[model samples]
Target: MMLLIKNAEVYAPEYVGRKDVLVCGEKIECIADEIDRLPVACHILNGKGLKLVPGLIDQHVHVTGGGGEGGFHTRTPELQLSELISSGITTVVGLLGTDGTTRSVENLYAKTAALNEEGVTAYMLTGAYGYPSPTITGAADKDVIFIESVLGMKLAISDHRSPHVTIEELIQIASKIRVAGMLSRKPGILVLHMGDARSGLTPVIEAIERSSVPIRTFRPTHVNRNADLLEAGYEFVGKGGYIDFTCGMEGQPSPGECIVEARRRGLAKELMTVSSDGHGSWSNYAQDGTLLEIGVSKVDSMLQELQKMVKELSVPLEEALLYFTSNVAEAMDIGNRKGHIREGADADMILLDADLNLDTVIAKGQVMMEDKRIKKFGTYEHSK
Candidate 1:
């Protein structure tokens, strides 16, 4: 398939001005100010008033569903293809959360493959919030080295629900992943689910300081859950570590607010990324740790927060886009193909109206959504 988008304002996550973008099959073919000659059977999209940017890459999502804090019945549902397409997410990384037993790494891997078969690009992390990390091949390092879709591992810290992993234990885990990542040429990162505990990022700080493991090996998320954690995230960034801010968490500053605040504090902008813990459970707990209520987070919050950043907070469109696009791809080591709109990159792009509303979504040169309507649906979704 060939797609030509003409006369659109392009951001490439850095303002490229008005240009025409060409896509051949699954990769971008060319980008120019004008191309008068058209390919045979090519589809031309009039992008006169639209803004074209790389499709968003969500680095932290519970693609197979998360939660189970309340009980088995409270587990959230798996992500649907339409949900991702409508939100302009062409690439995503799936991972498990609290329930590693009930939710096997095998299921997570299958769902990751399913998302790829359905349309959008998908990758996954092995393990959950537990210490002895769960894996499809009986080892976390093997999962990264052998499994094609497994990118890294997920673990929790500074939370009551966490297994209270010690610094030595954390370093060991990072070491294994680091070596395995080197072997597989993947990030092999340990994505830490930051909690609101008083310890904040102390353990992660000590782990990096005391070990030979690089600071980039640890990707702490939910840094915006509270002021203290966010401050700690700034410190982590100062130490050459990357931090992720979660969108759609109640009582937390929106990812947009967090990014603006990070900039205000003069933190490293390239080291910060944002994600929507999509399809993951969001629960309220009593002071005594009783589960008060539970609800699922929306995937669209990623796009919504970006819109708010540009339209409401006065952030430049290119600057607001970095957290969702290039920054995330770079953090996960998929920058060469996934995040940019340059020629030879994957043709995963989204077109936005003047208001920054999602208008069209193209993944790997295939139109998934256009004019704010879904053109492609998951295999089972069409029946519904």
Candidate 2:
């Protein structure tokens, strides 16, 4: 159906004036001062007094399901389509974490394909929480180079549970990623799963200096989980590297505070991103290495973080929106299609009421939620 959204106080993450957006099928056909005239038989949405931002792109999500660190019983179930849609997330890049054995790359790949079939955009990373990452082709480079959905490999760095890879090992992995990305024209980012190990990002910086891998290739996440990690993240951002702060992991410093502090410290704004880490376990480690406690992931944390940035931190709406949308899109090299509201772009958008409540969620021109109610859900979500 052709749809026209009229008089939206649009913030394509920027204050574009009062404009109308016309969507044809799954793509935006026009975004201008006025659509001139609406097509016959088209649905019209009066967006008066509403803010329109690009639908969020969460780069580091366990969409297939994460958490098996505590045990099989503690394993979090896979995320449902509505959980993401209701949270204003339109595109997601799924990754495997500590449960690579039970949750294979094949399953992650299949889940991504399934989400696409269900009308939500999804992509994935290869490898998991181990050295010598498991891949469908038995090689990380081959997977990223050949598979369209495979963007790069993930490394568990500076965490006690990690493989404790040396700079040489990290460099070698990044080398393969570089070559593969060069051949495939993909951004072969090394998505690092960081923890509160306290070793800091020194090793990562050294690895970049010693190898051909650019600083932008090393994407470290979980920066807001701790004070020192946050400081290290700012340093990385200053050095032209990107940092990802995960929402829903509590008991550390305030994530909102860290983001505000980063801005105050004059860090590059475009290099920052926020992800949900949804469905992943947040296991706390005691001083002696015992698992103290854990928590289930929440899909709403992405918006929670965004709200914190805008409300508590007094961050402008435009800059706040970029953390969850455009920054991630640029980091993953999906800038053309995802993470922005533009003509000829995917019609993925979120309409927020004046109170910042998610009122409408549109993924690929299909309304998944309206008036705080979900209109669509995943295949197994409602199964008895």
Candidate 3:
């Protein structure tokens, strides 16, 4: 598979000037100012007026279904590949959320495999919201080491859905995940789901205070759910931890506010990331625990936030993109292959128009989307 992309205003997430990229098979073979000649079989893309960048990677996505909270009718449908391709996402991390009983780790793993086999790169965490979280091999630690795609585990902290773990339990679980990561030579960090509670980060703080585990082991997501949670979450980020914000919700802080606030506080830019939480259920409840409303998150929201950060917020292109591409790839410990555009890196890229709309998407040297038309879909995709 030889592909030649010509006259691309390239930003390998760092503003590399106009260059031509050559993709050989699944890897980038060469990148230069000009490629005078290529084999007749090579596919060429005229990238004039288009900026080519590393493909966007969504770190938190529910590829399989995620809800069951309200009852049997509320379980979300599995994510579709059309949603990802049109949004410029070539790599995604899938996880199980809320319904560990009805939805098993097997289903999540199967979906992950299906997505990867279809087109994009898909990875997943092992456990879910409960204590002694569900695992394929019956042990979370062993699953992380033996499973090729199981990189870490996810747990809900300070949420009504969580197991309400003690400090000791937190320490034990974190320790196990960290050890599994070490054994597997992968990033075994815990992905924490934060809720709308008064004790925002109390459990995380207590765990850090009581144990010697590295602070980076915890990744508290949905920090931007509320102003108070963002405020408290920033403290953890200050101390060498990471936080993820969910995008596309109304009544929450805009992209400008969050990025500007992070700059003002001088937080670690690399530790910050944003996710769509796509295909998961977003619920609103009354004080009495009755479900009032339910809405599903969209994958397009991640692309929307990326556009907002660059165009509306006046953030530098490179700086604004780190939260979606390279920064996220590094956090997941797959930076070597997934993130940047380099000689030996994976051939996953996206071309954008002046307005930042996705013009084309290529994953693993295969063209999946072009000119706003989707060219690829999963195995069981419906034509209608």
lDDT score for residue 132 of model 3: 76
Kindly report which residue pairs in candidate 3 clash with one another: none
Clashes of each: 0, 0, 0
Question: Which candidate number maximizes lDDT?
Answer: 1
lDDT of 1 by residue, 185-301 (tens): 999999999988999999988988899999999999999988999888988998889999899878878888887888888889999999999988988778899889999988899
Which prediction has more favorable lDDT, 1 or 2?
1
Candidate 2, which ten residues in sequence have the lowest lDDT sum?
Answer: 248-257
- Candidate 3: lDDT of 377? 79
Q: For candidate 1, which ten residues in a row score worst on lDDT?
A: 35-44
Q: What is the lDDT of candidate 3?
A: 0.89
Q: Highest TM-score among the candidates is held by which one?
A: 1
Ranking by TM-score: 1, 3, 2
TM-score to true structure, per model: 0.98, 0.97, 0.98
Residue 15 lDDT (model 3): 96
Q: Write the per-residue lDDT of candidate 2 for residues 1-384, one digit (tens) a residue.
A: 788888988988887978999999999999988886453778777888788889999888888888877778888888889889989999989999988889999999999999998878999999998888979899999999999999999889888878889999999998898788889989988899987787878779889889878888788988887788788788888888888888866676555677788878888889888888888887877799888887778778988788878887888888899889988888888889888899888999998888677888889998888777988899878899
Whole-model lDDT values for every prediction: 0.92, 0.86, 0.89
